[model samples]
Target: MKQRLNLNLVISMSCYSSLYKPSLFHTTTNADIKAYLVGKLQTCKDLTSATLTHSKAIISGLSYDTFTTNHLINCYLRLLRIDHAHKLFDQMSQRNVVSWTSLMAGYVSHGQPIVALRLFHQMQASLVLPNEFTFATLINACSILANIDIGRRFHALIEIMGFGCNLVVCSSLIDMYGKCNLVDEARLIFDSMCIRNVVSWTSMITTYAQNAIGHYALQLFREFNHLRLDKPNHFMLCSVISACASLGKLGSGKITHGVVIRRGHDANDVIATTLVDMYAKCGCVHYSTKVFRRIQNPSVIPYTSMIVGAAKYGLGTLSLQLFEEMVDRRIKPNDVTFVGALHACSHSGLVDKGLEILDSMNVKYGVMPDAKHYTCIADMLGRVGRIEEAYQLAKSVQVERDGYALLWGTLLSASRLHGRVDIAVEASKRLIESNQQVAGAYVTLSNTYALAGDWENAHNLRSEMKRTGIQKEPGSSWIEIKESTYLFHAGDISNCNQRSEMLSLLRELEERMKEKGYVGGTTGVVFLDVEEEAKVEIMSLHSEKLALAFGLINTPKGVTIRIMKNLRMCRDCHETFKLISDIVERDFIVRDVNRFHHFNNGLCTCGDFW
Candidate 1:
């Protein structure tokens, strides 16, 4: 009732505003009236003020003026009164490119990309040549949709329409390609630009960082500094830090952290959240916790990052504590927050807790459960040897047809781990039937057969894979030694110049390992039909083991050796490292494709569960 009364008073004042200043209105020209309306619209910070000012404009006969009406539309959008903005736009007698572009941009910002696209088509059909802003806005819409086809269409249009050099358009193009996973094309655009701004540089770097091309991202950051471009802002710093995280480059991450501190961006929410994730990913969760604690009032993202970090480190209890803290503080959890929570349960073997959270996702948290949540739950079940339940849960996931690929792959992986040949075959069949060319699924099944000593089946599977052109992605790992990264593939030491020293050190470690009861498992030797001794030798040369050997010899005794791998660490290497850690009494951090394993004193942070 009070709200209605205040609104009625505003209406009365708006209707009688001219009467209150009759002499001024009589003396003022239409231009003066239009200017006054535009000024009012510019300062309209709230819906009530905007509506009052809008009514005054209508009363003063300036509603028909395009410039003033455009201001009104913009002001209405600023006040989040989209209905009023669209109604005003529709009623406009003269619609310019700005009018269409403004409405389209509003829709895009409001997460309605399809509406923005429709408006763009309508704008084109109405014969209004889109300005740079229009092209940039629609390109952003394309990026949000991650639709490369539409992005390409806009790229061609921008080129033909002579907007290719426009900074805004070029940056949007780079971002669109990045979002579409066309990192190479994004780099092409970034390289060809005759003029580059901070936004473009950030976009290109962000593209590399997002795509796991962290080394390239660091290279770009170095060039960005060499060119003496604008100083790196929080956005660019966040991207560089993310690159460090992806590569698990603690040295680089520390340097970037220094930059964050010097620039006083440590307090910035986005940068702080990114720092949490970066430290966590770089195998430094203590730093992550410190940053998380320093946040004045942490949001869902920061909490989620910390939770995910804990989950990765097998600190499931801590993850749940942070989650409860967030809820107690009245910070609502988003879908990603729930994902991190579920990951905590999955990683820590909290099966009952995971199921409870999954069940409460929609009912208690108001966040709907999707295939992603189901994947975590299924993993939690699978980790505990509930293979059938996991498979059934994976089957029950209802999502986009393509989403089944992850489900199938998960089931296949779990089945392979538990030696469930029947379920592994079933998962592989589903993969084939769904036409999901997941090379990893076939590789897992083939490895499963080999592990079962069914060499004939394994050989046949390999033949089938060759016939289908589904080659498994080769596994590789790299370690950063004294700021230089050295990569190694299975049994391949040709790429490193210090291969002999690395081999010598590896042989010594193996001798010490055997003395410490480390008879290497032959489980990872699936592709070969070699003798057990030969298999142990083959396992010793796996990429991650080679990287570890290199790190152990090169780094100082007290320093933590960090290595990053492109695939999950094999069980033999996992066990070998546990023993090597005990023998050497040094900390070794291995960031694999799955999770980080910190081996210290014959114990892994994963507690041997992972």
Candidate 2:
């Protein structure tokens, strides 16, 4: 019998061998060397004659160059073998910043941002000088974690390293600050940049869009076109679409769709999803549906966006239809997709459907209910007067104890809606005790107490907040006018241009609202033992009214007014905006901390659910 040596066995033996003596493997071509010694490299198992030319480079005595290490890291990451990747990286005799950065990237890519940050700090402690890639990975992790302090320190380090002008690092910094909710800082960085590439422009635009600075994003997009040596790509068009969605600038959004079509990005799934979101948010339900159907093969993201849009606009049935269609297509839904779907059911008061879907989350899809999912369910239940069940469900959730703020806030607000003062007081206590630092919880709890005639308890809660050094956040709103944004807080008299005129206009709007049966909503004066007039004055000067008045006076007649609030819009303001829209015969869109509210012809999109 002829003894036939198995080539694969020999290669596996060689690949898995520990290189005790590096010299034994020195003779192999780099193309013939194996970088990692696992059972069988997936790359090798599928190897063809064509890969033979490059095989020697991967074997032992292989130049374990940084490029080779990066390739190995890529393979392991693709295989979801992060542990092996880390082990390989640790065993390397010579390691550079690239090796460290690649490992950090693996951690980030695997959604372990904290691990990535840890490695970054370790690399720093080891005195390994980092490069642009390392800083970018670290900054990206900081962005997701929203560790502003860490991000700022990294920013200073980048400047120290003289890498601030590096385009890649600059783009990452802009993205970091943007995602960290520091949009102004991001813009500052963008403006100071000596060079701006497509990535830089995209990051800035998307930052503005994400921050709901839609008009500014559009302005930047126009500037981008004017300065461009190249036509707009899919990413740029997507950002513009998102900005349009944020602002409810549907006319402009449609125009951008035309641009996208011209640029041949209209069929792109990401662009299509953004377009659907824009149309839906702009109150153009028909166009939104049309855009949803135009995508021949929609992905989960677009489907989710469409579902969310439909739900937000009160097209609950349409949203359910899309959800069913998504399931039929066997497309897996992510957490965000479920939020939209469940939110739609909540909006439509489809209690049975909502409960069924919530159960199926774990039973069929293998995804357990997280805080956001539970919050949505609670919000839906609370909206429809299922207060006790909502409270029980909230109490049952163990993870995300901080979510009690949102859950109890919802419960308290619902109690106020239905005159369930007893439950409101109970939930309020839970809320304040759970997270006194959350301003919204304080506001909700206080309002609940006021509704129940328990002003003393409400006052005590407010006093506790103050004593604990938890300052109530000012009611703040943003208005974009003529390509510039102006922020207004309660009682703001900060306008240099036509200050007296703006103040007078606000006073007039308040009087007009009063004449239309809108009261001052003095319930917000939980801490005040004085007359209601002072509280009324305070309510009149609220940031939403100020911003709305500014937009009214500054913008063209019949143009819609858009405002973004840092907190939930007060009940009085939500009602007042309804009256104001009817009075001015114009549309209004307010994105608050919780959700979007659109007012047109004295009707709110929320239908008073929020």
Candidate 3:
């Protein structure tokens, strides 16, 4: 097709012998010139920069009608030369709605959504009423800004102009609301829509997934499937697979993968990458690797996903190997790739390697360290008992207040782990001064006091937290079995039917763990003046342990148990999981808030580093 277009372009340019003679060009009709230019603009590939430049030279001397000018503007926009398009738009003697919309769309395409919005207001002030496309573009701008107020205003105008029912406008509104973190509002608009298309459905699915309502997204996808109004496309499948990954639903993800295969989209790069991510997040690294290897000449997305997945599973060596391979293949590492590599290093206790990567990121890859990158480096340093170095690094780096607070919090956690009370105090003070409402700082400080045998100070801190109306977030864990997920909170006994059995199994495991020299660590329990036995009991009822016990009772002996936690695993729980894995001879994979911990034969992949 491109060859044919190029041949036509050459033929058309040759026929324009009048280019050398203005008198002959003046004889040509405006309508005929406009028709020819518009055809070329529509057919020529945007990446063919040389051809576009030649076309631009040819059109420079010709008189253009509004129709031809609009085509030229659109052509420049498609080529991502927004400056050229804007200049052309400004030089036009007369403008119409098409002219204004063309420039606005150009701004939006060029990642200047704010500029696009400003131009939209200017167009409205000029009394050139926006068409449906104009409204759609403005709504998308609102979505990018994530401004709910502006989006509502656009929605009002859309309804006032009777374009609320237009499929494109409605879809944009849904997307805008979703990006604003108003998924309920997005859903309301979706439900109210009288007409829907594939794009609309996909937008709503993506909205739910983006808002962390993955289960709802999957449910909506199921409803869309039941309707059978349209077949699922690659975009829809990708969104659904992402939702499954978020919920760690391996069964549903596999079903979706099967659908992708049946639809012959398994080879598509995007779908393949999504599949790899889904399987990896679901604790099936083998399957993720299998999907990744099937792609021929895989791009950075799949490679980065695989690296991050390996890191999540505590396969740091494997992640590093993949990074080296990617470099050997001459696929330049992006910021995300470096992040995965550093994360893998941190999880595996490769502090020196992580530092080297951090130092070379800007020099070797031309990727500067962002806040996330710095945080990974701080975590790596802190993991290996280098709290002072981590703290100094955090202080030296220029980051936003939130990033600084996060770094301090990590330092505090490391101090607590390594019994560095002085450093913990310093980090806690800095964190509190920066952000008074950070509940983690208060909790960690109180725990630090408890660990130091200062029960009175710990109690006072707890009282202070109550007085300040600050409450720490509750820990929760979930496990999936037979396509169903069961959630448990810390010390929760809500499941009356299974609570007794779970508790009995936990007790049996506790005895076995005790026999294997697994003594409970009481530092995690913050209660003052608690007996040692009571503290052990309290620690045994942690959410992850409950999930683990449930998995042990229900799953076959040989099957691996996977648990996902909403917070960092406590020391007691981590040790217990290691012992349990050895006793039951079943591998345990726990995905905490930070990273993955694989327990096997009384050992963890983190090597007691995390």
**Candidates' C-alpha lDDT:** 0.71, 0.64, 0.69
Candidate 3 residue lDDT tens string, 1-610: 4442462353255335324653345545744665666788877676464355435535544423456667767877887778767766675555789999889888877789999989988887888889899999999888887877888998998999899999999999998888877778898999999999999999999988776678788998999999999999999999999888877787888899999999999989999999998887776778999999998998888999999888766678888999999999999889889878987888777889999999999999899887678777877776677878877887788977656665677777777756678887888898888874267777677767776777667667777877778876544456554544556543333442455554555567657655656565442422221112113111222332233223211222222122234212222343454554564455433332221111111111111211
TM-score for candidate 3, residues paired by index: 0.82
> What local lDDT score does residue 363 receive in model 2, on the 0 to 100 scale?
84
TM, every model: 0.83, 0.72, 0.82
lDDT of candidate 2 over 268-338, digit per residue (tens) = 88888888888876656678789889999888988998888777655678889999999999998888788
Q: How far off is residue 13 in model 2, in Å?
A: 5.2
Please provide, for model 1 over 149-214, each residue's C-alpha lDDT reduced to its tens digit, 9 standing for 90 to 100: 988988998899999988888899999888777888998888889999999999999888877678
As a TM-score, model 2 comes out at 0.72
Residue-level lDDT for 572 in candidate 1: 34
After TM-score superposition, the amount by which residue 29's alpha carbon in candidate 1 deviates from its true location, in angstroms, is 3.9
Candidate 1: list runs displaced more than 4 Å: 1-28, 490-610
lDDT of 3: 0.69
Q: All candidates: CA RMSD in angstroms?
A: 6.8, 8.1, 7.2
